[model samples]
Target: MALARRTLTPFGLWVFGAAASAPMVVLAGGIVATYATTRVTALPLTFLLVAGTVAVLAVGYTAMARQLGHPAAYYGILANGLGRGWGVAAGMVALVAYNAIQTSLFGLFGATMAAQLGGAWWVWAGIALAVVGVMGVRAIVLSTRVLAAVLTVSLLIVAAFVLACVGRPAAGGLSWEGFDASGLAVSGIGGAVAFCVAAFMGVDAPGSFVEEAIDRTSVGRATIGGVVVLGGVYALAAWAMGVAVGPGSVAEAAADPAAGLPFAVLERLGGWWVPLAELVLIFAVVTSMLAFHSVVARYVFAMAREGVLPAGLAQTGSAMRVSAPRGGSLTQTGTATVVVGAFALAGADPIGVMFTWLSTLGAMGLLCLLLAASVAAMTAPARVRGPQAGAWEWRLAPALGVLGGSVVLALMVGNVGSLLGAAPGPMYPFFLPAILTATAIVGGVWAGHLRQAKPEVYPGIGRGIPKTHAVPDAINVSI
Candidate 1:
């Protein structure tokens, strides 16, 4: 079943992108984590710089997305621009990445709520997982409303914090040292940039909803606009954090108790805002999870509809006469439950282990996908990319995007130790790339198998549907 069309506006699309970034969570967890892990106090500058690079990526990304009407953005772009095999690789990576990122939030969600309420971390995560699962199978518009509402409150909290920090600057009045470029010259700045880039990870989400958006162009607007708006929010928040505790002391303050740093700052500077901020942050993470869950369900739906996976996964449920990807949503819910349970059984640190590891892994894979898509956009034929194929957006922007994306990817990978807190070792810090490589290899092999066993379905791997492809009897169920 297809997603409901004409249900999302430019504003709604922007909300999906922004909410997935989880503004409060980013300000609280991500920004402070960057300061502590990277020991870089110029995080405000890092966010601004990363935003510029991400905007470059959006140029080619949106252009490619405009050409394709598929629900799975990265998969369609890769499959159409490159080949069936490459598209399969992109699709597998995307599927794993989005799921990792979505489920990763549960760690933070559980921990935050467990502190607020009386329960084990996983218990709160399970409650949210159930709530998100229900919402995931509802109408797209319904979920968007939830995201928009929660994100609005989160943004307000963000604004409140920014105002309070700027109002009560430490020592010698207000200072601009956080924006100083000289601070970025440190060894671990790449780690700071990587985390900052993660803060904007969801901005590309509008592309995933292109087919559901009221206007395809709105996807472009929302994606690019999200990058700009989020950049400003993050920069301001990071700067405010530095201002609250003199810039030079920002690293020291953040490192003392990194995860609690934002709350401490808020409690000190804003007096009474800490309670509300923490409450909203937990909900903000939920909204973020909902946004990513919605995106993942669509990806599964798109792949299934094309007969790439079990065709039964393409089945739908209805809300307000609009179809929701029921089978896909349920599949994601089940997968998430299993992962969350395993972590809980092992007594993992919700924030340190689950959130830190999986989210970064997701971000890393996505950066690779972005780089590949940029190359695909630059190389695709004029006919395949449609009328505006030869424009600067299709040509120059993607070229620059590839360059910028590659540098960012290199920096991020080079500083993996700081990002993961892994000591000098071969097994720990190297797990992410190894997993991605293994996934790509598996995808390539799967594509080859499909080429021989299901030649009829091969041609339509990335185009959304197949005119002649037959569903495999073993996995295809009539629902």
Candidate 2:
């Protein structure tokens, strides 16, 4: 069999990097959850936590990336600093979490479009998943290009919707006066922030292709730049909806922002354009689901290849030649399928239940990964401490990152029960994070002490990691 090429030009890298992060802007179900909170609670505190957390994540990620060098380097550093066991453990959690989220979104895509298509939602979901899976199992360039086309068209449609609503009346159309932040609750504020933070979660994914990024030195810049683009898009989408419909009615409209708000506005401006806007809204969700599914599957493949999970999860597809690890990939697909099946069984609203759970879990996992990464950053390279290290690692940076991530994690975990009302696996709040953290700790202890037993593998732990080059490179990447 011919091996699929692993080549990714610098431009291709940027596109993939941006597309990987694009899902955060579109398919992010967390925004719906946050809107519900704002409508039910206070908006000011929600704004503070949401704004504050992303700002912190941005700083921490940038500083930590400087030391780690590249995406894989970040993972490698975690393995080296925390122990290989921990690296595998963190990688596993990330892999599973990404797939679950992607799969859940698949259900949403199916159900939403099904309603419009006048067919079974699961059928739509199956169709959507099939498309995503095929793309996911193809070359990175192919996947990125498809995602870019979907993303650009989807965005243009939304932009048009927003512009059409500019001068509409408050009663039935655009109403900027309703952007209030007075009703937020302390818990609700934290919850909203947790959800919004999910929008910025995929910025680090492109780093997975560090070995293939056009310019290694540019990885950090590109990653950070992606975050900024995500933030702006999210803010615009939120503001446009918040202003047009008013926070008061966000509840009923929360189910689908693009369709709910933008469609309403379009109906007022040019009634004939309403259907077009709604179609675009549907496509946006589809694009997001496809984008997320591809990246998450890739994550599973990478982790399995590194032995974080069983060997099976890291198996690459014949076409993509970058398939997930064997056991990990199976686990990812299984988890997603189960969730979608359950939603189908419960006859529950796919977008509300499955989407919420996936986004919530994604949020929690993201915080956990950041915390682990930060700790690793702080602990790595202990033997070479000095201004050089201080300037590079920003030990303080990771420390702060941990603190910031911890706060977000705590808020989300604490309210998991409250948010979901104890349905969807009654033990989720306590169990999921415990599983994630425990897995990492166990892996770390195992890897760190393996030197006493498996001495051979121990010595080469840091070798071949994308970030660690014996010679100088342009990406200025470290990990």
Candidate 3:
């Protein structure tokens, strides 16, 4: 069954995209880790630079969405643009990447929740898994509202961090050293940029909601708007951190493991803020997981409907008058349980195993998809691209996106060990790319089999539905 279309307004789309980015978690963990790992003080500038690149990527991404009008994101785009074989390959990569991201957060959420409240980490993970599965089958409006409330508090907490840091100037007197473009030209900048880029991993999530948005334009607005809003908040908070410790010492201060930079600064406020921040950090991670659950489930639904995977996964459950993709949600929940359980059985570190390894894998895979998407936006058949497409949307923006994506992809590759924290080894660094490559190969082989045995279905891998079943473009616009 298709997701309930026109059920989400532009604000709902924004909330979904922002919740996926998880602003508070980025501030508390991503910023601290970036500074420590890269020793780069110009994170504020790096974030803005990366955001501009992503914003450029979005220009053609949304234009492609308007032309295709399909629920499946990369899968649909590649299928229409590159042909069914490439589309199915992308579908496989997307499924694995998104599911990895969705389940990996269980490690962080479980660990954080256990630290604050008493319980086994896996036990907490199981509980949240069940909760998300249940919520996933309900009317999406319910999930949107739940996420909106959680995201609101998370952003407020981020704002508080920025405010507290700005209130107290260090010896440098409100230093803007973190914003220095020259600071970014130094060594280790690639690792810093890669880390900052990971913080915005879910920004493209809005494209998946295109079929469900109240306005088709909201897809681009939400996608680009999410990047800008997230980048601004991250830049402001990172800069404020430099202000609190003096920009020159920001990287040095972050290096002191015991100090816990941002929290250390917030503690000086000397009230309930730190405790509140901790509690909300747990919620922020859960919200991020939930947001990813939505993305993964939709990918499952999109592919399943086309006979690429099991068709049963396309089934939807009607709860309170809205058709929710319960089939897809259940599949992801079950898969996550097995993956998380295996890690637990091996006595793995939640942060080291599930969180670090899986999140890094997912981040690299998503970056690959983003790059492929820009190329597809330009290469898709002109007939499928629609006659209204312009030079900027059809060509220039996507070309720029390709250049930017190539640079980011290169940085991430060069710094893969840093991102995964892999020890020196023959194959450890190549692990992520290897997994994605094998998965894509499997998908290609499956497509070849389908071409031989199920010729009809093979031809329509990425196309959403027959034209007869589609909502007209004029009607979609009016809605």
Candidate 4:
């Protein structure tokens, strides 16, 4: 079948490309910025680890681009390398993980907006949920442009606010002494790294845009450029927040991880501008939500087309408005609705629930994907590795990156109580184990049912994976 295509303008593509990085930046940088300055001190090791992990993503991403030729190249590589089951599993992880992060942020945004505006809690929650509905099912380009404009304006306002504080440095404040991490928790390092990496989630955005690249080289160039830009943005933004607010003030700045940094800085500037700052941050969060929804929608659409998922997910908008994965759009929309509606119905605090469930879980899933993708990059053939071949990116770098990331991933699961502050009760580590197992079991059962009920339609499971194979020691990445 001929693949569906969208009629997005060049500008729209650029917007999608840029906007895709916004949520990750805020999630990674803004949220962490809050913790770094206030809750923790300037631990060189912590900052270095945070910066190094992000920098490593750039290196690995560039290597993949050199080898793969385009973002879609991973689709083929993964399908060939991991077998169908694993590939589909990878997609499951990505879709659910990304949605978790996006959904979690919705709660955070609602709570912050409500507090800043002093409005009815339900009204703000309703508005945030409403935005999700509108943005969730729309064509990618339309959503991207709107998100780009919002991110640009919101970020500018934040930058100005941060810079002003630096220029007029508060009395007896702004000194290097506060950078010390002496009293910080060694145990918290893993948690910090976990969130630090969340900001770089959009590094994979360029892969999704492979089809739109002017050429193969453009795909490679764009991928490299995107990662570099993302790392720089996070590092600089975090450092700025540290300088202006001091490391001791992160908890005070935004007691909640989901709170916007600009709103806190605005309060410092003057009490009167609090509402304005809140509104600006709301725009940023909303834009971030829409941008991520579009990105994840494409992943679902792709998985469907490949037969890893129901074909309906692969369906494009009527008249080729977008080439979103078929059958996936509805799934994506449905998931978002349930996530948004569940919290609303339960009367739970959006930010608190978001912090506890969606964002943290999403971070876990994304980390898994990154480690898997790094292995894919390293194991790819030299012909495809291009210039980055034989370099650190293809050699010790990915190996170490995966090892480091996996360790952090394990810590996140192990320390879930610390991060989310929720006891597993009798389950201990069983909560994560149960959730992951259930998701995998459901996905596996669905795949099996598809095989039995509609053998003809089943896209064969990834290349090496047998229908009933065991999970291998080596990481797999395709679905």
Tens-place lDDT per residue, model 1, 313-361, is 9887866567677888999999999999999999999988998889988
Tens digit per residue, CA lDDT, model 3, 303-365? 888888889998888776666678888898899999999999999999877898888888888
Point to the candidate with the largest lDDT: 1
Give the per-residue lDDT of model 4 (tens digit) for 1-479. 11222234334444554565564346334455436433554432344565466446445544664344322333434434444445455656666777887777667776766776787555675676676656656544456567767767655655666565565553446655333456445445655555555555554555554443333344434544555555555545555565666655654654554555645565666786666655665676777666666667666655555566666666654322433333444565578667777777888876656545676677666666667767776666655566545668676777777777777667667666545655546455335545655665566566667678878645654321123211222121111
**What ranges in model 4 sit over 4 Å off?**
1-38, 43-48, 58-77, 116-138, 170-174, 177-187, 215-227, 248-264, 267-273, 318-327, 381-393, 423-430, 441-479
The lDDT, on a scale of 0 to 1, for candidate 3 is: 0.82
Candidate 2 overall Cα lDDT vs. reference?
0.56
State each model's CA lDDT, in order.
0.84, 0.56, 0.82, 0.56
RMSD of each: 4.6, 5.6, 2.7, 7.4
Please give the distance, in angstroms, between residue 404's alpha carbon in candidate 4 and its true position after superposition.
2.8
Better candidate by TM-score, 1 or 2: 1
- Evaluated with TM-score, which candidate comes out highest? 3
Minimum summed lDDT over a 10-residue window in model 1 is located at 470-479
Query: So what's the TM-score on candidate 2?
Result: 0.77
User: How many Å off is the CA of 274 in candidate 2?
Assistant: 3.8
Q: Which ten residues in a row have the lowest lDDT in candidate 2?
A: 470-479
Q: Any residue pairs clashing in model 1, and if so which?
A: none
